[model samples]
Target: MTRLCFLKCLLDSHAPINLPHNVEILVGRSKITKIKDQSCSRQQLSLKANCDDCIVEVKQIGINPSGLDGFSLKQNCLYKVGHESRIEILLNNYIHLIEFQPPPDNFSPIKRNKRKIEDEEITVKKKKCNKTPDKDSVLSIKEAMEDVWESIDEGELYIYTSKGVKSSKKIAAFDMDGTLIKTKSGKVHPVDTNDWQLAFPVVPTKLKEQLENGYKVVILSNQAPIGKGRVRIEDFKKKIENLVAKINIPIQVYIATGKGFYRKPTPGMWQTLIEKKNDGLSVDMDSCFYCGDAAGRVANWAPGKKKDHSMADKLLAENLRLTFYTPEQFFLGHSIANVPMAKPEFIPTEVKTEPFNDNLISDDKEILVLVGYPGSGKSFLAKQIEKKSSYKYVTVCRDTLGSWQKCAAEATRLLQQGKSVIVDSTNPDIESRSRWTSLAKDMKVVCRCAKMATTKAHAQHNNKFRELMRINHLPVNDIVFNTYKNKYKEPTTNEGFKDVIEVKFNPSFDDEKSERLYKMYLLEK
Candidate 1:
């Protein structure tokens, strides 16, 4: 009679069956059936197992099933069966139909002497599975960045180059795209890997030198394209990896895919790195410096050159209370160049804080018109009046409603309910402002225009700041700003405004971040 020892536990589904000798075990969807010695003589079994349906792995060998072939459980002497510690192959799949009777109460696992040839074969397989992964096999960027930063939010994924480098005193933060790399196509935006080229050959040498000088080199970049589905996350990760390899230096990278606190100029990414990732070490703000290309300077106009995109990088440094450097100044040791702007002007009392009710009719419904450039603080002023003043008017802007006609329709509907309305928009030209004046005439209310004293330069600066910092909001680019400027006709008395109050472009936000942002929005050279 064949001496068979049944498994101690009755497997409701699939469970490990500790066998006594070298045996071929056949596993079906439900149960493990020991193949007879006669059946093993003929090669008959072949099937592919997808992980989604069935996942198999031998825990002792550290081998996870890859849904391929030539892998199966066998009673081999490599890890002796019932050596008190039996070879455990972890079954990570649903199983069914296992019928067996209990063994004798005194039953004990059988152990046999280890075999030489079979054990050597199993050892080779284990070594192949446990070896260090090569570069190409590394799937995600985070896998390589294992230790640098502890995840506070999995939604905001970040990558690091070397082992986590913690330093309290010094850090060198740089921006990625234009500052470090540019398109090979000689275009502003990248098309593919072929389009990428190093911005400066000195970048790697400089960064490596910084790393050796007791400074933690980090890349803080805004990668909104990743959030918008314009760029694949995996491809972006690979791009970062390629850059790091090319630079041949250990660096940590933080990419802000969407605009939020962590995005540049907000200082959230820096704050996280310092408080969470620095391993209780402190950052010396005085010794740290940030570098980027968006200094908002005028176009270089030279061959194969472009204007600074925005002043966001400088503003980001300002917000962090750290020393700031342009890419030219930091990497090339060049002096700061003259930043160009279109007719720069500044008025200290740009924003008027006086009572807006004084400009309002006491008991009559009024149609308040806001007239300014695209980013002239017009919306801010209108909202301020509606909140502080007793007017409590319903304010609407064309940007929010999609069009001027839509805004007028919404305002008309609200006015019919005996509510005062404020039309907040960059009513730059007479034709644009006429819609409001006409609406007021139809509503039979007094029309008042709050003309903001914000210059074109100030508006453009503000536009750049908003475009870089805001999420889900459409960017108000030079094309849109210039479109408005082309038809701008300075608000006039003939526009039918009962009273035109000169509203200064002052905005007071509650926090330092907002205060810093306000300064950046108005900053011009």
Candidate 2:
């Protein structure tokens, strides 16, 4: 979180300040420190350092100027390092100066690089923990700061191990937030330590039992909010430490800060752990099981519990071919029924083809309008028409185009060259469909509406599956899908569509990954 503005000026000449005026320079201390801006003003350059042992003074450059050497500034003027500053220093061999410019009047204050006191505070705690601790049991301050040896993904993923017997083949993995513990305030995510409480009174007992049963407990959780740069990494670290202390057992923890193969249901973390951290012991996949809260289930809230957030945990188990259980099932000994979702229409493979027949339109010049929800496979179907059909149609999707109007313009140009165009967008309303039909009519070509036979539940399921799978596609959230649903108006022949064909959901994926994603679309809400 630290945003350091390093101002370094090498002694190239004796008179450095004589070079340029209005020269911008960064001023940073040799040692890391936090300077809280109390005024909260873009124009105000006043700053206060949190360290009581440090003092700011204008001195000779060679005296370390406290790491401010290159700044082109004036003497005896109040200044701030990151926001605004101007300083001048004299040295025996060269003159060093540094200047920090204030932001523009309209600039946002939120853009300021904010740093938390967590690192400094944590370093102090680590120093205390390092003293007189066992070399193998407790990590040295340097080792604790190092990245996990098994992690290949981006972002800072800290690994902490407890002092306990290691297991080569058996590992019991559990999720953190909702599975092991929850906020005492009943909030989804807690802002502070005091807000948390154990998910159940028996959590510690259950973990101890697992340890006694020769299972090395490991925590695999997704903490995506950390990647947003708001939540301090030290906060997450402190939480993990507190959880381990509460459990009072040897365990390992891994938190995926963002979406990636390491995130749940991808098996990247699992693969990395068993391959690199297991000390050459082969993992018994049959005996090892994963527990998480996102097992697809009917809602547990209010009159009818809302459906579980997702089926990511269950799917992760499926991907790994391991046993899967909900927190309630594993901890509370409850049998939560697996909620049925839409069945996937077809199996997906490494190479995906259009799941349904898309040759309904002839190779003759025509304007084909597509209508569906965000995750209703409109884009997939459109790509199929271009890939599998004889038309070799020019497909235009709103996702890639700047606007639908731009899509129409492209279609107009392509059709002028005697090319058939497929408008592969969610043409939800009659007015939207008319934009294409009007173009086709003006060109004396037939317009057809290929309404996808996809339901709301199916679309939502598909969207969630896409997100969970981390597919290389634009993410479609509930808001985006809902907005399309609200604006949808069934197309009619009167709207200029010469024919309307209901394209069935018959996607075929050549790979298991693609097939799993398609099944998500088929899952009944």
Candidate 3:
């Protein structure tokens, strides 16, 4: 029997594959293994074994470069592989040692054992042959890299294509990690490459129904671990491919790989689908829908259930103005109801009509020192006070000056010129506030502290909102907020301030659109 073996094809070694002499046996991504490597072509190589010579002629037809015994084959050319050789695919991305395991006892070609050959061939044929994927798949994963996927926004967003996914007027979008599949390891995050299974038994049937009903299936996922260095990019990508292959249906995938515009609760990916990936077809908003596990349900909303991870998915659907549902509601027969999440304490619409300051407005020259968390709206309030002619002041912001010393220098200059200065920085403690208060004494102006009424939770909510909105500011990390909270001391008249003003948080939106988003839940918990 003219037999060959692929050694080291997988973590678990593959068995020898028996070949029919003189017949061109097809070897490809689908034929080789269930795990599809996009770098490896579907029709990667063709092999014809010579029973007499114990050699195989391999034709390099695929776009990916192939190595035969360390010799690179010319495009569309044939290279003769000896009894024992090594083939490197895609520059050693995968290496397989090929061995010629001829019939036992060095039997001659003419006297090949028919029964043994038949048995071995049957086993290898079963291993090698699987039904090819549907031809209607939309993706072109043949070449090493093709138009099947595109990474934009500096790899923050990654959009993928499949063989048969057709853009229709309607979209049936779903989240992947929790809604479609869960880690078989029973962990919140996947333990490794193999740690996954369909989230529920009915997911496939429900999704297939969507496909049959002319709706495009899409996986809109947030895989921040790729950028966070928690998971290898290649491994996660292979997992995605495996999930798609298991579904066995054409669908598109949108991955937000970072904490940026494409992340959920932001309309970046949805807008991209409409503006770019939709094949020039306008989407029917009324027919479109989204389903996810992060539906903002509170803890114990169901038996043994924890609080939903975040309201981001529900907020995403809200921003898109599409029908939203939990995976249970969409796939299982769970009743659809309003997704309940505790609204953030501060929404622009609910801002109180109370004055920003507890005291009356004055044109008196004074040093206005603000104290709070990093995103406590102090700088914004300072700018607002600067805009008023009666409260005109040169804002001495530490953020712009880059240091407290620079802020002191600028404030000294402003005060020397008889201009009142509003120092906008997180003066969280007595020590932090004393510097500005001391400066006020040096300037011989009455110092007043405006301790913002916004709580730490409210500031965190605002920080997340700004991140989702892509506002012109760097994201405030938890360390910054925690540092302020840890050091916070209540501002009082005892800190040498003439007045300790409690500034109520009365949010004002730039437009109706901003106001609408602010009303949506921003905090995950």
Candidate 4:
């Protein structure tokens, strides 16, 4: 049987302390990290967790200090710690997060090898006398980073490069998040700025080798949190500096904080480098290479690993016309796997062979109900219908009109005036489609269902593209997609429609740049 972690203490720069349910475990200074800080006690806090309920029975035992989520802990009293509790030991600002995790299988873990944890922590190094925090470290880092960072594209993109980092023709570009480092706590996202470690032990060695080979080692990464305000720019700057400092190599870095040209697969960052920052020298795409983890590999691409987050990294190399390598293939010398890649649903480059059929409406007295995903270009198609029909059909959208009842009323009002009506909305279910079809039946006009054949992948691509390109685009979450998929019933003549017209997703862009971006991989590979 697998031993499940009932309650686990996640410490920075330390091995996770896995505690079984109902069993008490002590957490403190050297037990977590070797950092000798006098503000922490040898036994700071004692915790007993119940994984099923996701609650911890914790007690402060040490006088040095221990607090839950910045709240004062009363000594000698048991506190019911919630799943979100963070136990701080005041140990040089290092936080010890205590989380309760339920067992994966049916059987709840009754006990664990508690003795092993104690044995492991016992081999700690000798502690120093009353060690204090280093204020100079912050000052030194700020000094080193002064005048090194600059932003463009209205702060969507940030470039951080020191004068010491020399430019070269043979580039060694890499993705930072999964390629060079990963969250130390093994969480999908870093809990704090300090919560990252090298992805592989030999990361530094590999980077050093790149520099030795006369390649300009450059790090390019998309950090959306920076733009979303989840992560402060100053904090991320410190993280980048810390990472480069650890490697102790002359390396430049580009960070795409927001979605746009600078974001990978667009080649904007690479273009900017060659155009502005490459010391008036052109880069050699033939010899240069890029490395990232998002190679469009599926789940179990590696043993016990999930699929890659996106195809941005691999697509970036393709856009730059450079050779690409997964971090595994580059650092570990692993051969490339023959996994099938996820391709874009539409080819924007393919010239429009056949003219678009504008005869969507059979008559002026008609109701055309559109049904598809939100980003499936429902509104765009509705506008085209209104134009092709020469203003004969008035578009009724739930998004603008506020409710389906209002949409039906407006459609009824338009139909009564002898004008055609186009219902533009994600009418995913039969009930939603029935609203318009039922109205058409009462009015004695033909009700046709125009079904958009846009896949989930394609819809997501269009959604992302709009979000990045349009300034006033509303955000569409995955929950919306899930809701549509769960309730969607394919529209047929069974729903009282005169005809179900199948509409293929053919994108109409305002410019060539947009046309190119739409052709690229935007979905998570």
> For residue 17, what is the lDDT in candidate 3?
53
lDDT of 4 by residue, 1-525 (tens): 433343333423566678776788876768456647776677777878776666678787876435553334546677775544556555114555555443333435342210110001111012221322232110111112222665555456677764357768889999999999999999998999999999998999999998899888889899876654467767888898889888888777888875566778777788777777777677888989999988777787767888787888987787677899999899999987665556544433442424456668566489999999989878888888788878898899887776788888998888888899999999999988888888888999989989988877678778878765753334576878889999999888988988898887767778887777777655444
Question: What TM-score against the true fold does each predicted structure earn?
Answer: 0.56, 0.63, 0.66, 0.67
In candidate 1, stretches whose alpha carbon ends up further than 4 angstroms from where it belongs are: 1-157, 182-188, 194-202, 297-306, 337-357, 362-366, 373-446, 454-487, 506-525
**TM-score quality measure for candidate 4:** 0.67
lDDT of 3: 0.69
Q: For candidate 3, which ten residues in a row score worst on lDDT?
A: 114-123
Q: What is candidate 2's CA lDDT for residue 386?
A: 77
lDDT of 3 by residue, 1-525 (tens): 435433334222244455567778665576454437786687677777776676677786777656543224444777676444555554333555455564334534342110110000111111332323232222223211211554554456666666666777789999987899999999888888789999988887888899999888888998876644456656766787788888877777888876656788777788787776777788999999999888767877777888877877887887688999888888787885644555534443455545555242346778888887877788778877877735458798776666788889998888788788888988888998899889888778889888888888788877877766656554477777888888888989998999888876667678877776676555544
Tens digits of per-residue lDDT, candidate 1, 479-499, equal: 667888788887877889887
Candidate 2 has a TM-score of 0.63
Task: Rank all candidate structures by their lDDT, best first, as comma-separated numbers.
Answer: 4, 3, 2, 1
List the candidates ranked by TM-score, beginning with the highest: 4, 3, 2, 1
Decide which is better by TM-score, 1 or 3: 3
RMSD of 2: 14.3
Question: What are the C-alpha RMSDs, in order, of all predicted structures?
Answer: 21.0, 14.3, 21.1, 17.2
The residue-by-residue lDDT of candidate 2 on 296-392, one tens digit each, is 6655432455566666676677767789888878998876555443222322232234345646557678988889987787777777787776545
Candidate 4 residues lying further than 4 Å off, grouped into runs, are 1-147, 153-155, 186-188, 338-354
